[model samples]
Target: MDKTQNPNNNEMVIDLVDLAKALWRRAWAIVLVMVIFGGAAFGYARFLVTPLYQASAMMYVNNSSINVGSTQVDLNDLTAAQSLVETYIVILKTRGTLEQVIEEENLPYDYETLSGMIEAGAVNSTEVFEIQVTSADPEEAERIANCVAEILPDRIAEIVEGSSVKIVDYAIVPSQKSSPSISRYTLLGLLLGAVVSCGIIVLLYLFDDQIRDEEYVRQTFDLPLLAAIPDLTGKNSGSSYYYSKKTSGKEATP
Candidate 1:
């Protein structure tokens, strides 16, 4: 048996070189596709999508007795404050708090919509929590965040009866929009475009069964080459050529 006739050796394999050649052949199409997708993403981010601004207010919990002196700090009080911070976070998102915020701010949105835009969480494992609000208007986000900060204390006081919540940092109007990230969108678009373009190129390469080179024909037929016919097309007459077997054992060329 011929060593070359082994099934493993005869199996067709696609390699990096073939992929590179395929991509090179379709470079223009891939570039066009990338440009189209990238432009669309830029347009959407810059013009079509609504920009959103975020504002955050931080508050600290003091879950100690009211009679305790300000100068005296206890470890137990600190631990209690840290534990109660999570409870305050939940209370901040309750319907009552959100309703009050909507009423005081005269917001156009309802409780569910307003709740969706508001985020409250403890800062790590500490006794501090932050209230973040996102909206289309920068001033509105700031106002909502501050409003929540103001009302959250009263709500917490009502719930825990004696806990103190103090605003550590007030919300400020953001100078820049947070949503519709142009750079991120553009990068995603570029990646998506490249993936789609590569997929199309691979599909085209797979479906194209026509023999393109002497090596392909030789591999497919297990035959020895004899001669080559040069394609005299004006565009690629200097580069493009094909191989053919001649009746004589000697090689021939054209």
Candidate 2:
């Protein structure tokens, strides 16, 4: 028979169908491993990991005074407000402001710890930026965020001569947790379990060299099949031949 042209004639790789069969044969085992790992991950995330809540406050940066009933506005002022966000972020993250916040709230955390929990960023490249504070307790997160909102404006005004920040919205207590996602952890655990299990099975299938039957031999060793026989005597065993000995001296007893 004529075979199609191929680029890789000698390169050998594991058959995907066989690998899939091996995985399917151990489907129950794989599911069990996935469940075990997923349960463990869920337990760890739900019970052991500490949950955090986040409270957010919004602030607007005012670059200059806007005249009343103005038909047109200067685009440069809007651009200036956007540019001022970076400088304001730097001042907001300073140790001095955080120290004052710690003093005002009587929080136990130091500057580094408190700074790690706070996040500040511009809202969609606009003049409005948001400040978020995360804590183990929702009420504490709200308190810290509100305290920053109350303290940051005057602090910025004092530092930057003309620049000032105005509070657009105050912080409110968060109703839901912001971290320690149980479902995500569980899914990751399940995926890891599946990868490990399937990897081991595939490795075993690829490295195994034991012969199973005649068909396996023909496919792997490129040997021609000489003959084959059906099972006889109702025994599920390997092939065996039986024959009567030739009658040498005794006459044939038809």
TM-score to native of every candidate shown = 0.80, 0.82
After superposition on all C-alphas, the RMSD of every candidate to the true structure, in Å, is 5.2, 8.6
Candidate 2 Cα errors over 4 Å, as ranges = 1-11, 223-254
lDDT of 1 by residue, 70-183 (tens): 887777778888888888888988999999999999999898999999988888878888889999999999999999999988888888977879999999999999998999
The alpha-carbon lDDT assigned to residue 151 of candidate 2 equals: 88
Off by over 4 Å in 1: 1-12, 65-76, 223-254
Please list the C-alpha lDDT of all candidates, in the order they appear. Answer: 0.81, 0.81
Worst 10 contiguous positions by lDDT, candidate 1:
1-10
Error in Å for residue 62 of model 2: 1.0
> How much is the lDDT of residue 21 in candidate 2?
81
Tell me the tens digit of each residue's lDDT in model 2 across 1-254.
Answer: 11111224744555667778878999887888889889999999999999999999999998765554778878887888898998998899999999999998999999999999999999999999999999999999999999998889888988997778899999999999999999999999999888877788777776776544555544553444444454576665665332222333222110
lDDT: which candidate is best?
Answer: 1
